[model samples]
Target chain A: MRGIRIGVCLLGLALALGAQDQANIVITGSRKYQMAVPDFNALPGVAPDVRATFDQVLWNDLYESAVVNLVGRSLYTAPAPQSEADLDSAGFRQAWSEPPLNVQRLVFGSMQVNNGGLVVDGYLYDVTQPPGGGRLLARRYADPATTAGARAIAHEFADDIIAALGFGPGIATSQIAFISNRTGHQEVWTMDYDGHNQRQRTNLHSIAYSPRISPDGTKLAFMSSVSGEPQIKLLSLLTNRLLPFPTYKGMAETPAWSPDGKKLAFAADMGGPNIEIYTINVNGTDLKRLTHSHGYDNFAPAWNPKPPPGSPGQIAFVSSRIGLPQIYIMNADGSDQQRLPLGGYAVSPSWSPNGLALAFAWVRTGGGEDSGASDIYLWYFGQQKYVQLTHNEERNDFPSWAPDGRHIVFESGAPYRTQLFTVAADGSVPEQLTSQGSNEMPNWSWH
Target chain B: MKQSTSRYFLTAVTAGSALLFSLGLAGCGHKAVPPPPVPAPAAKPTPAPTVTLSADPTSIESGSSSTLTWTSSNAVKVELNGAAVDLNGNQSVSPTQSTDYQVVATGADGQTANDSVRISVTQPPPPPPPPPAVQPAPSFAESVRDAFFDFDKSDIRPDAQQALDTDAAYLKSNPNVDVEVVGHCDARGSAEYNLALGHRRADAVKNYLVSQGVDASRITTESVGKEDPFCTETTSECYQQNRRGHFVRGQ
Candidate 1:
């Protein structure tokens, strides 16, 4: 029996890996999985608003995933199935699988209020299969019966559907940290990937910049002037308090987290004439200098999200060695330094979650001058070419890739009055994410 | 008595004959010589020549050039620095040292008027006083002036060099005083890149001070990027004013 159990586990792992491979193909190819999502049914005692909130959030999450093409509800000729009994009906199957709709998969769910909390039951059906064999996923989620709770339940359900469909992890639960002076002082602020639940994380009362979330989502490393000098400060997200960090002799700014969440790469002068890159442990130990060009300023280091096995990840940073700052890649230990071969002014590089491309702000016309406005560009390593992701935007900068690898969040607008915005990696569907007083420097969470 | 009278008569006759011969020769010449040309109005004195000379940039660096311009009226001839030139013109002059350019205007009546302009040339500062000996310590505001930078540049400009030289001299004399140089940028570039640029500015200042014989340990550097700008206007002059390396007394 033990051997059989082990064999079952191994089989499950193989199936998951196979699904992941198929999902990659779906993402890279021109075709997307055609699926239909009907509004989740409200069982007795479920508030109408709760059901509406869940349905809206779930639909948005799926659409933004960009891995599936959702069929419009206008094409539905019959009512949606809300339970196994309704799903097994021949009429429901015919409506979803018919030529006009031609949906390959269908997702439906039910919501109910129990013990003053919300409970959601979701299922995915492969309509191409026979009615008895169509069910592919079934899961239940529970939360407080509030609007936020309903949204949370919906997000969880959508993430589960995405995972089962073989798309890697979903970004519905990720957050973004940015700088906003809405409180009359520059402070660190965070929001959900969909620009919901904006909350201030730091009350430093002093200016703060570059809030980078840790890989484990437990800490936020940012540069602040709380002590009257700019220094890297680590804050415990779990504890909501500033942690102890060593005070270097010079200025420290623009801290980036290593993938393991164990180290941070930042730029500092250290009582010298040039700002070079350095790495330090999260606990302020094992300080290592990564770059040594004497008179050149090197900064804004971004670690590759995933490096080769048993190898230190590569770091993309801005260097002004050959005049205007340009993107340069070096090993985490500062070896194999090479420019990215892009001309004009390039700064603020952010590595894509897959580590195959870099998203950065580039002024293609002006060489480090204010005469030209900045736009976001992506340099794909494999293709050896660049894709312009923004155009004719006024000073769009600080491009941070979403964990899903399909979206990037950046700050845009005129100087001193900028706001945060998000755009798809393909340069479509630009969305404004912030409208308060002067927001800039958005860093997306790793998860 | 009769003989004397006869001699006087012969002399008078000789004078009369000479005068008649000269008059007959003039009449034979050109239609009676036009009655000896009427001597009528006296001429008005030629107006005194008026001249003005000036230089476009009255002062310049030794190797640089300045333009000398002169305008004169009612003058037949004009000379700049003893060389003939147009009455109303400008000439570029690169003098090796300080020079005074003079313009002389001469009227048709030969009356001359003179005007001059002085162009001051400043030589490059001597290789920063060779490691100045211990001197009296000047106040921070007097000695440590802010070093300005060009847009997105960290290389030391000549003016910046002069400010830093004075700062270096002060730092060398005051061995116990520690200073912090904070770099800044205009609100035009990405915040992250501006931070790096600010650091470059501060570093450049510190390096120049060190090269001038101030101990490196007496100085530190910081970069506030564009967060703490000195000026907030959107003009180029304001941006330039915001981009600087500000010096502060170390805590």
Candidate 2:
């Protein structure tokens, strides 16, 4: 009897552990959590088309998150469970009769139009838990019954679901600003996180490069050769107003806004013969020179979004003082400078939001006869090492990190054209984002 | 008495000339006094164009100005050093070293004449205070052996010391000459970081020179990073050659 009781207790503990999914997600593995997203059931007042649109947008959002390997409805031999009552009645175990539909998680939702607004209710069920009930998370969102609003509502729920799965947050709401020569000149353009609803931001009618969105997302700073020389320009997204940043002597390129949004640091040929790092306030006051190098050109300053404790001020930038260009870290006031132990040509660094790592374009050609092509690399500050995030493919450059610190949007091209591409932080799944025209210098907006 | 004698002589000559004229008119055999013999037509010769060239000061210190004045006569055109000029005018010319100004004049008959003036430019005399012991001027690029560093290092290398030593020795002798130490890097690494690294390399050379009896004030350092490489070839030797601290004499 004692032996039987002990065995029963061990089995019960094992079942409990299995039911509880891991809350902390380590994104560096190949084991993907299988997820199923079915068309949302339309209530009487809701048009079936609206419900279909909601389901489609939500499914795409979850699928593009890159972590969830979705199972399509074609794999299911039986009809999908639409409502909570239906799911409860049929039991979660009967939701899918097909072998592949037995996913770890199942997403089912319902949509309806009520009082001129769209209401969406979504649920995530850990199907491995129990036979009758397997609900892990649920959320309800309402918005005006418009296409854009409905899509936004779905994205909100998807973001919440992603957050519950230990991912930082979904980037569905963020936008990427990049330079595109679609209209005969390189202008700053912004598109939704998934490359939808692209709109031109700056009509400078001139070549623009390196669009940096403010942390608050109200202002955009970019370098434009509009005034016949490259100068930093700030645009107020709220008012559609554009103003030139008061600069000293030479041209300014590569503007990066600080995490606090009070200052803008950029690479400009000012106060010296060569390009050096300078910071100016958003209101065009308090100009400060962060570097005093009169010889070697220093630029591409990326302010750490999250500096380590006791060092609230830290910046990573590219410097060629040694021989080739290498990444260097300095304090906010340009002190305590140290080189990141990376070799070869590294430039255009974009710091991750979490400040644990930086993404940059690097080529490891040791000045031999080989002209090494560039690819994206991630230098993990915590690990004090680098990982080549791209392979020996086309030339890649100008990496920008998404707010979630998971996706990096960069530019890749070979012969006559280049386009924007987004890859997971782990260097997997490089998805081309832009194709119509030559695009370069992609910057992810702050959420 | 002289006036009376001249009046009487004029009257007697007038009567004789009248009798002669009457006799000639009456068909008497008499020789008519011929008018003074007409002078043969004199030939007018074409005048050759004459040119005058002069320099106010034939010899001057280098970079000093001199006045060159020239006048040409009977000339339709005048040119100074292949450039047309006024027939008579003065021009101020500063010959850097020594130069010759030639003036050519063409007369109306297509005849040409030329003259030249030379201005010798000499170095300014040494100061009254006897010059210091003569020493060769420093060769900026040659005197600095490029203060080469190891891969990705800004520290001066042992092999590069000879050049820096020569630079320091020259700098010590010529205390007034200031030099600029420009740092360079190979075409690799982050351009911004390479700039900072290049700065450190130039600073390293400057510091070393200062330590070796060269005045710190005589050295200013800058870095071109990898933007301006000495050698663009992809060879290791080229990269090593590019990673250097070049020397430049400052004004």
Candidate 3:
């Protein structure tokens, strides 16, 4: 009887080990971890403006990451932690009060005015920890008491929290170059990635579009129609001077920079009435024709951000050779061309940084092209399946990827009232980046 | 200890069954992986525009001329690289060398087609014995006239044809003079579009002169678009006067 009991116990242990395979607790699909960010508490002598600015800016930056699901403040049933000292108090127990609220993490901070300057203390805690200790991240920033300085401090702190949580280096420090018509003509205007510090970069006083910032982020290349031809022009950020590229006889537009930044590929009418993809040296030498579509317009060339193994290079471009516009991938030298398995009026192909997927604007067609509205879609090369990122909203086009690879900026509008907007790569939490005037063709900076 | 053993046994049994059920539900274990298809070459869905070019006289004297006409039904716009003519019009071309004029037509559907017409200008049958008398001096200034266009149209208006005819006559009378037709547009729409419209306007003037029996080589064209408006004042009358093709003599 003793031997039988021992045998049963051993059998139970083996079965339990087999059943508790951690991977078996499978989620249907991956999702953002629920995170709660309560408003930062103000120190006894701190001004309300300082507290409000820091809290709002930090929340905006963190929420823009899209990897974390921010919990609403109304659900918080605990007292707000005022300072780092409060972490030692029982009053801060609310940070980990989880159950009814399924938040997995808590973000709280405090701000105070010291010597006419604002000082902020930021913290992030894991809700799964016990009340005594759950500090996952903590940082402090000091800045002049100006509103802009306060906002900058908050952005820096939010970046710290994101990096600590391993969500990739944050995009808060990046900038976006977009075409805006605020000065009565379409010119290149740049602003902080979150839509602050907007200033005009080009005053061509003519129409310009497709502003692509170089990898070094010092120069901008765009297609301007000021010289009576749709020609590619470059603007120096250091000097604010506009330099025209070597003149091609026909119209030139849609300038794309190669990953190495040594070459610019654009659509030119060099061969025929319809444009073809052509690559020219940055100094405008060694012009090479990449496509011969037999008079079918092949424009909008987007070089792959990362090249695959055993190939010179690869590019994702939109070609209208099949009667309808579709995304096509080809070697950089224009060989081994094949179309993506998509059927629609698709254009504006932007390759993801990892080269695993392509984000493009697609207007679904039902035997005819004019009926459907344009929306952004992601085509996963690995899965060979696509998911629509935007649905039945305003027409969203020109989906350019952010440097972090987790976000995309695109133009959204009907016709005359277009604005720039940024969204997560998986298509969530779209934040309007520009609203003052008509903005379009936003290209995220490489850094 | 005995109770703990019973509880462990119960939990193990439940978890083991759940694992087995999930594995069974997964079937072949990969719902997301589908058979990959070999990429094939893209299908060519449609052909480019079809064009035809024919020279009216097919041959001309060394200094004389012949008309070259083209017809393209599928195309919305046609371009003669060096010569300016409408989508379906004729131009009297007198090439010093035997010249082949290629016309490319771009359809509204974005397909292009091209054709060429060669005009054989005969080598002047051994330079005719010269007439000993002196020729009259080249005349200008009075014959150079401004031609107007309709709102945005580049075609020569019925009223503007008279001025163009006078300019054509002056060029015919003085074969030694070569002129440039400068095109302009009013301040409206996009600058680039205006530039293109301006070029078309100048080209239309050159084509009209060529059809009126002026040597095509003697007329060059340029478009300043809305940049060099003849009238800078912001008024409807000024804009109307600015939309014109001006004639200028080469130095």
Candidate achieving the largest DockQ: 1
Instruction: Give the runs in model 2 whose Cα sits over 4 Å from its true position.
Output: A1-26, A29-31, A44-52, A94-100, A130-134, A144-146, A366-372, B1-251
Residue B110, model 1: lDDT of 94
Question: In model 3, which residue pairs have backbone atoms overlapping below 3 Å?
Answer: none
The digit string of per-residue lDDT tens for model 2 on A121-240 reads 888877666556677778889998877778788888888878777677788888898888888877888888777788888777775777888999888998776774457899886675
C-alpha positional error of residue A165 in candidate 1 after TM-score superposition, expressed in Å: 1.7
Model 2: what is its DockQ? 0.11
Ranking by TM-score: 1, 2, 3
lDDT of 1 by residue, B70-138 (tens): 888778999998999998999999997999888888988998877788888999777766775877556
Tens digits of per-residue lDDT for model 1, A30-80: 456889998888988888787888889999888887778889888777678
Local error of candidate 2 at A19, Å? Answer: 28
Which model is ahead, 2 or 3, in terms of TM-score?
Answer: 2
lDDT of 1 at B144: 81
C-alpha local distance difference test of each model: 0.82, 0.74, 0.73
Better of 2 and 3 by lDDT: 2
Model 3 agreement with the true structure over A1-447: per-residue lDDT tens digits: 110100012233233334544221111114567787888777776666767777788788878876677777787776666665665776355444546567777788777788988888788877566666778898888998767878888888877777777666677878899989888888899988899999899888875867888878878889887875667998887787886578778567778889888888887765234568899888879999999865356778888878888877898877767765678999999998899989866778887776777888876661122222477777767556666666654556788888777788887764345678887754455677777778888888886
Worst 10 residues of 1 chain A by lDDT: A1-10
DockQ for each model: 0.26, 0.11, 0.01
lDDT of 2 at A352: 83
Best model number under TM-score: 1
